[model samples]
Every structure is written in structure tokens, then in C-alpha cells.
Target: MRRGYWLILVATILLVTGYHLRFQAPATITAEQGTANLGNWDFTHQGPVSLSGDWLFFPGQLHTPASFLQTLQTTGGAGRAPQTLPVPATWNKLYRHQSSHPLAQGRGYGTYALKLTGTGHSSLGLVQQPACTSSRSYFFPASAPSSQPVSTLGHVAATAPQSLPHQQPVFSALRTRPGAPHYLLVQVANFDHRLGGLCRAVYLGTQQQLFDLQLQRLIGQGLTIAIIFSMTIYAFAIYFYTPHNRSSLWLGLWALCATLYFWTRANFWEQAFGTGGTFGFAFHYTVEYCSLLLMGPFIIYFHHHAYRTRYVAERLLRGNFAAVLLLCLAVLVTPVEWFTRYYTPLMWLMLAQLLLAGYILLRALHDRQKNAVRLGISALPLFFTIPVDLFANLNGKPSGSYTELAMVFFVFMQGLVQGRRLGLVIVRSQHLSDSLAEEVKHQTASLEEKNYELLIARTALEEANRDLKALSITDGLTGAYNRLYFDRQFLIEWQRARRERCPLSLVLVDIDHFKALNDNHGHLAGDQGLKAIVSHLHAIFRRASDVVCRYGGEEFVVLLPNTSPDQAAAAAEELRALVASTPLHYHDQEIYYTVSIGVGGLPAPGPSQQPLDLLSAADRALYQVKRDGRNGVGVADVIAADIRA
Candidate 1:
């Protein structure tokens, strides 16, 4: 009845209020280049709302990062004439950049306006398309490949008259063939961000459904492969991250020995593995390989950093980065075979690093915080979540059992554990408070008669109240804060950040296809998986200031204080990969589960400034991660992007 209860009630009310506010308003976005004219588009964000209309997109020209950046930099800000560019064609060969190595100018820059009110045919084509060499397409980030060749003409003209009831902002398109038949149909309220382009779909007669099905199939395939990759990685992670945390270079290397997945993801991968190659090879050589190499040391350092083993970890990181960078540069100019030779040590280095991380954690348990011990104890059950069928999957064993009863059981258990974690926190808190009160009452000289008894009662009540206050938001299953707690905490943090003019970050963790796991395994195994995760996360995240909480259902949230989006992303990625690498098993089934994370952060200066925007941004980023294929992290900032509409 004192200020305590009032404060708690007020806090709870405020949080609930904020939850609804989140869905109240849309984030304003600014118009940019192609987006400057779109009429039928939606504003679902707070930053730049470029031309994401019912229009056509002159997909990017293929250029090296340098040239691409130059174009962006030159035309990015305001008050600049649009560059003269061949709509969808690259300047790679035209500019004689074949020998430019990693610095080739292959990007497209420019915008064209158009309008589509009815289902009419209109052709927006390109001139002088790049030659489609199978090798070239494999390694590069291709926005759109030329489906067919276009004829180049001296000039092109817009024959259709622009007519509409209102002067509406339309959309942009790429280079059009001087003469070609093109038609587009724009539908109202059917705005989609699926690759956000004007003339997003080709109206090929009544066969539109076929294209849609094909597109969906392609996406489905990518997703299928990604899920497999994630599962494999997750299984390996848990297996590698045993309670011992000792070096397992041999095992880790064995797991990662295949380049098939990596190659499949990159354009250059096809160059090396594909029948004919080297067209899309430059980007892979310079950027992609270097990126992997850079990650090697970090992986090693994280795994082995805790080890008493000193110089090897640091040296590995430095050397790996340097080696990869050099290799990347050489890849730009050198052939695949020559590059592969230098890349050999990279494999050894990666294996070494993974081993180091394992050892460091184990040793840290032995000589240091021993938190590793707690994590191990807590994580043992997760070791059981490994699907029984995992061995066959790894060994390329002909999926001996499609219907894995053991795997199903484990997933079921994980769900139960997750549910219990969510539901029992309050019951546990109450129990703890009651027990504490009883103990204190008995210990205290209650009823020194009446006066003493009254004081004792007051004390018991006070202690119980405090305990309940703590229990309200904490998750019973994983000791992390519950969604209720996380939301309240986020609001409070947002208020603080606003008042103090500081940064706040949110990491949203989603166990990949957890629903499938639940469907396969029983509820109990799912619960166990959740519990293991809560325990493991607690150990990895030792910072007292950080907040690890359960955010509704299977999603977990981590809030970092005074951290940027990138930092939050790095932290999330590390945790994700670590979770993936940790070997969790159950019964005969041994399969892995991965996570897709989204990070969002912003500067908040007051309570009046809502926390919903940040949550929305983070959610958008998370959505992007999932859409792009789960098992990764995406940090999106509408503000940094100057998004407005």
C-alpha cells in the first residue's frame, strides 16, 4: 500500500501503454532518387523512403566497390545533376576496367521516371548489356542479370504521354532498349518491398502465376539450403562446445572442411567450382575471402581468448587477417588455383582458432571464473537436443531416417522447457518470497511481544514485496528477464537514453525453425532447448549492465547499454555462431539449430520520445535477416540512411 506497490503498478501500466503505442503510428521515410516519384507505396519506417513504388527498377550495374562508391558519393547528397548512365548496364568493359582488379567500376547510377495506371504493355530495356559468362555471375552480387540482349540505338524517347488525375510521384527504371515493347500493370494497395522495384513483375501473358511460383520455388530452395546450413552449423557448434571447452582442432576442422556451402553463397564460388569461371570472381577474391579470413582470428580469439594460452591466439588473428587481405588483393588479379594455394593456411588457421576458443573456455573454467562450469552444467541438457540423425547428415549418410522420433522428442521437450520458463517465474518468485519471509520471521524476535511482533510482520511484508518486485519481470525458466520485464526495461532505458542523450541497442534472437523442431520433437525437448539457451546466454553475457530477457514465445532479447548497432550486431553474431557451434544432443537424434538475429539502436534523449521506433527498426532489421535467409544478423537504421517519405 506504500510507494513501492504504487511504483510497481505505475511501471507496469506504463509498459503496457507503450506496447500499444508501438503499433499506433507509422515511421516517416524520405524520398530518394528512384523512390522520389513513386505514387503507390507505403511508409513503414522512419528514414529514407526511396522509390519503392509500383514501378520498374533499373537494377544496379556491375562494378567494383570503388567505382560503385564513387557513384553513390557523387550523387548521394542533394543538388547534383543525375549522372548519364546506361540504365541497367555496367561500365566495366566500356570503361576498359578489365585490368582494374578489385577497384573496377561496375555499379549503376541514375534514375528514370514512369507511370502505369492500367495493365498495359510498356518496355523499359537496356542497351549494351554485359556478356553473361557463367563464371562472372557466380562471385558477384548481381542485382539483376540481363535475361535477354538489348539493341543499342543513338537515342531513346518516351512515346506514351504521362497522364493522371493528380501530379503523383511515380517510380524509376533502368536503361531501355531504343525500341522494344514493354508494358506494366500497377495494382493499388499491392505495394511490395520484395526487391522494391518499379515494373517489379513481367506481365508475360497469363503465365504470371508461373513466374510467381518459380520465384517462390527459388526462394524456397534457398531457404531449404539455408536451413540445412544453419542446422548443420548449429549441431557442430554445440558438439564442438562441449562441457570441456578444450581444443578440438581435429573435429572442428573435419566439420568445416567443405567449401561447398560457402562457394554456393558467393559468385566467385561458382567461378572456382563452376564449369567455366572468373567473371564474378573479383569480388569474392577481394572482399568475400578477406571477410572470412578476418572472421577466422575473431572466432579463434573468442573461443581461445580465455585460455592461458597467449600469443598463438593473438598471432593467429593478426596473421589470418593479413593473409586474407593479401589473398583478397591477389585474387583480384591472380587465378583461382594460385589463390587457393595461399588459402590453404587459412583452413589450418581457422581450425586452430576454433580449437583455441574451446580450450580457452575450458581453462577459464579450470583457473578462472568457473562460470564455464555453471554454463556446462546448465548446457548439458542442450547437448541432448542434438538430433539422432545428425551423424548421417554430416557424413553424407543417406538420410537413414526421415521420421526421427528422437529428434521430435527433443524438440517437444525444448518447447515445454521454454513454456515453463515463461510461466513459472512468478510462481517461483512468490515461493521464494514466502520462504524468505518465513525464515526471517522465525529468525527475528517476533512478538518481543506485540510491539516486536508488529515490527517483525512489517519486515516480512517488506521483504516479500521486494521479492515480488524482482520476480515480476524475471523469467523462471532461464533466469533471464521475461518479455514483460524486457518491455518495461526497454521503456525505462529509452527514457534514460532520451534524457541522457545516449545510445541503446536491442538484439532479437530467434531459434531457426523452432516451430518445426516443436513439430518434430515433443514439447518437453523444446523446453530443454530454451532452458539451455537461457543458461548458456547468461554465461556468455557476463556484463551486469546488459539485459538478457525472453521476448515472447521462442524469441529472446538482449539489450546492450551504450552500444551502437554494429557493436550490438557483432555481439549478437558471436553469440549466434557460438550457439551454432555448441553441440547440443538428445537421444539418438543429433541435429543443429541456428538463430537469425536483428539489431537496432538509436539515440533517445526522454520519456516523451517513444521506444517503439527502436523496436520497429530492430524488427525491420530482423525481418531483413529472415528474408535474406536466417542464421545471420542485420542491423538497419532508417535514420542513418536518411530515410524519409
Candidate 2:
């Protein structure tokens, strides 16, 4: 019975060893595997291991897993000595020292072979594709048939990944028997003309860990999409409210471009368009190229509006648009080879745009435009990311969507800046409105005061005008009615007397030898004498029916409305006697003066008699008085029927 138990135990040990050999892989399959130590790694404690060691590189060759296995069976993959290249390093740079190599800096198919040792549940992943076109990765048991595939990872998509929002890397799951060897083969035959090489480290881990990692990536991508979509809608809404605000429009466009780019690079379009058609591939790359081109205008105009560079901003924005559009059109119409050949140079254009944007932002900050300071500060992340992305692209590495992440922050900060600026503008507008209202109030009060002053001036002017009219009809020297007043009165009195059949008489008085008095006593004494004579005339012609005026120099005329020639002659004699008796005080001397007087009358009404007829008759009588003797009165014996003065 003990012998039987020993046999059973040996059988059990043999079965257990056989099962372990059939399912689990060895810890070290070769010298290269020992260096990687995949079996020794603790899957639960550690992250994915880097397959960043030396790889046997074959250039200008297209080999599938079957073909590679067949070749390996024939010669153990040693027919031609393979070139050595480091994973996670650019193949272009690796061959840069070997200028004679046909694949050096020249785009073509390349196969990379490496050995990995891990348990049956291991998974393999090429975390990044330098250029995502016509690339494939495979993992299989080294001893397995060439026709069978352990696992296969196809190219993520034929989409360009220069811009943000690209698909996640493809990870392959593989199983190997215990103590058995396995191999990893990565084949890249990109038609895209770009620097060819591994940009990121390859990762090897358990299937569960890879699943968890992919789920995490999926979550990250989803969040990126949601953030970009929400921002796009928000910016578009802002643009709708302020249709003239170019910044909001550009921001919306920027977000939209980012979303489209992400869709293609992330292989979301693959599910819709599938990865087979040329159109899908072209469309994917075209979206990427267009998005890259759009970056310039969006960034430029955003700051243009934020900085208030309205004068030159629109022109620059249109120019940027035209340039980007033309370039995108070229990218679309150009052949694949042409695009690939110029892809790096095209990427360099982004550098130019970045530099230009930096200059514009810096200039805006320097000019002290409102919000420019904040916008510039917000762009610091983008500025840092630009050079990093540029270097990464040139070296064929994965930069992810760092620029897009920076843009998200930039957009948020810009929104805050715009909101703040709007609030300030509203405050300023209210203040200005209040100030204008106060100014209007002051102006209205001033205008009312001016109107009151004008009314007062108008009243004073009317009173002065009346006084001026009186002065115009009065003599300046004698304070008596002028000749013009006498002429007017003479006509009225003459006509009235004719209608009444009453007598109208005219009495004329002259200062005797007034010229001699003026020449001897001076004009001052003469003026005083004239004034004294006028005063006596006023006393003599006290009746309301009489009119008195200074007819000429040193002469006076008095019209008596209802008096005869006899009565007028008596009045003239009285005026002559009064003037001869009166004395005029001139300066310090009292000067005595004498006068001659004449009287005439219109005895009855006659149509042929005029006002001048009485004056001429009176003048003739006055000459008689002056000829006869000084200081006397004379009456006309007859009035002239027709006389002209």
C-alpha cells in the first residue's frame, strides 16, 4: 500500500508539472527576456512594464506574423544581420548616424522584433504610434504554428495625430505555456510621410491591468469630449448674444475644431466610417490638418478682441483665415505622397504660428489693453506646450492633447476676462450717463438765466428808442421843436383854419445882430442868448393851439391856431420886447440881446393856398421889421395866394 501511495504522489507531481508547462510562461526565455524580467514583475503592485530595451529592426520590409514565423523557423530570424534600435526612440534619429542606410530619414515599412516573458494572461500594448497609419502589432508563442495568432493589434486608425483628440493606443492580449518562449512583433508601413519611430514606451502587463488602463483612458477621453463640447456650446451662445464679438466666434470655432480633431484621432469616426475606405482615412487626416491650420486664427483673433485691437484685428484675422483655408485646401487636394513629404514642414508652420501668437500677445500686453494682461497670463501654459509639442512631433513622440488642455484653461480665463470687462463697461456707461445728465441740467439753468437777461435788455432798448424819437424831433441847442416839427404843425393848422373859416397866424422872431454878438462874445454867449430867447418864446406861446420851433439859426417860429394877424403881431411884439429885455448868462458874463419880430395870417380857407404861403408872407414882414428898426414887430398887409419856400 505504501508503494501504491508513492506511485500516486509521483503521478500527481508529473500531472501538475505538465499542466504548469502547458499554461504558464517561464520567468526568463532568453538573455533579452532576462533583462526585461517580465515574470519577476508584480502585476498587482506595479504599473505596465516598459519594453524600452534594444529591438532588432528590419527596414524596408513588410512582414506579417505568419511571414515572420516562417522566416524564424527557417533561420531563427538571423538570415541577414538585423540593425539594433532602441524602443521609445526615433528610428530616424537612430539611423541618422548611418547615412548610407536606405531607410534613414526616408519613410518606409519597418519591422521591430523583441522577446517578452510573461504568464499566460499577459497583454502587450504599443502605447503610442508616431504616425497612426498602416501600423500593426502582433504577439504569438514562439513554438506555435505560423498560421495561428496569439493576439493581434491593428493600427489604431489611419488618422493623423499631430493635433489633439486622437484615439488611444491598441493593446494585444496573449497567452503562453509555462517555461515556453513568446515573441512581440511591431510592423509599421505608414503611407504618411513623416519621421518614423516609436514615440512612447511599449507596455506589458496582465490582461486585467490593461483592461483597467483602457477603461481609464476611455474615461479621460469622454471627459475631454464633454468639456470641449460644452465649451463650444457656451462660446456659440456668447457669440449669438454679441454677434459682433469675434472673440466669442473664434472661441466657438476653436472648440468645434478640437472636437472634430479628437473624434478622428480617437478612432470614434472608425465606428461610423470604418477604417477601410480611402475617404475615411482622407477625411480623418483632412480634419487634423484643417484643425492644425485653424489654430492660428483662433488664437490670434481671440487676443485681438480681448486686447481691443479693433483697427488692425479684422484685417489680420481675415488674412489668417485665407491663409489657413488655402493651406487646408492644399492638404486636401494634394496626393498622399506630397502630404507625407511635406507633413513635417507643415508642422513647422505651427511653430511659426505659435511665435506669431506669442508676439501678438506680448505686444498686446505691452500696449496695456484691457484684459490683455490677463489673457497673456492665461496663455503661459499654451506657450509652454507649443515648444514641447513641436519638439515631440519633430522627434515622432506622443504629446497627447497638451495644447488642447492649455486651450481649455485659456478659454475659461478669457471668458472670465470678458465678463469682468463687460461689468466695467456697464459701470462706466452708467457713470457717463449720470455726468451727462448733470451737465444738461447746468446748461439748461444757464440758458434760462441768459433768456431773462435778454428780456431785461429788450425792455430798456424800447424805452431808449422812445426817447430817441423825441430827441429827433427837438432842437439840440434850444430845447424847442425843430423846423421839421414846425413844418408838420403849420400844415395841420393851416388846413384846420380853412375848414373852420378861422384865422391862422405865424409869428417869426429873430435875434437882432446875432452874428455880431457871436463874433464879439463868442459862440458860447450866442448859445446862451439863443437858449434865453427860446425860454421867453415858450412863455409867450402858452396856448395849446400854438406851436413853437427854432426855424433857423438865431430865429424862432410860433404858430397860433385861432389867432388873426393883429393878434399875432401883438404876440410877436411881446416876444420881441421880452427877448430884448432878457439877459443870457454866459460863462462869467450876463449878455443882453435884442430881436426883430414878424407876423402873418391865413384869414380864410382857400384851395390854392399852401403852408409855405404863410411862411413867405411872414418872412417878408420880418425883413420889413428888421429894415425899419431893431427890436420891433411887423404884420403882412396881404398874404400870398401862391408862394414857394
Write down the TM-score of every candidate: 0.28, 0.55
Candidate 2 segments whose C-alpha is farther than 4 A from its true place: 1-35, 63-81, 97-100, 118-132, 150-171, 197-201, 271-276, 310-317, 421-645
Cα-lDDT of candidate 1: 0.45
lDDT values, one for every candidate: 0.45, 0.66
Model 1 over residues 1-645: C-alpha lDDT tens digits? 245534754553354334333322122223333222223332112211211222222233323323433554576575564433222222333344465532123222222222222212222211111111110111111233243222211111111121011101112233322223222212111011011112111211112332333344334334333433433354345434342433223223322322232333323243334422223333444444454445445444434532344534456557765765675576667644345434445545555554555555556666654234533343233233223233332221212212222222222222233233333554665576667565545434324667766755575556455656756776655556888888877878777776676778888888888888788887776877787677666666668888989997788888888887777888888888887887557776765888888888764433434677778878888889999989898887744421233
Model 1 clash tally?
A: 106
Q: In terms of TM-score, which candidate is strongest?
A: 2
Worst 10 residues of 2 by lDDT: 22-31
Q: Where does model 1 exceed 4 Å of error?
A: 1-465, 603-609, 638-645
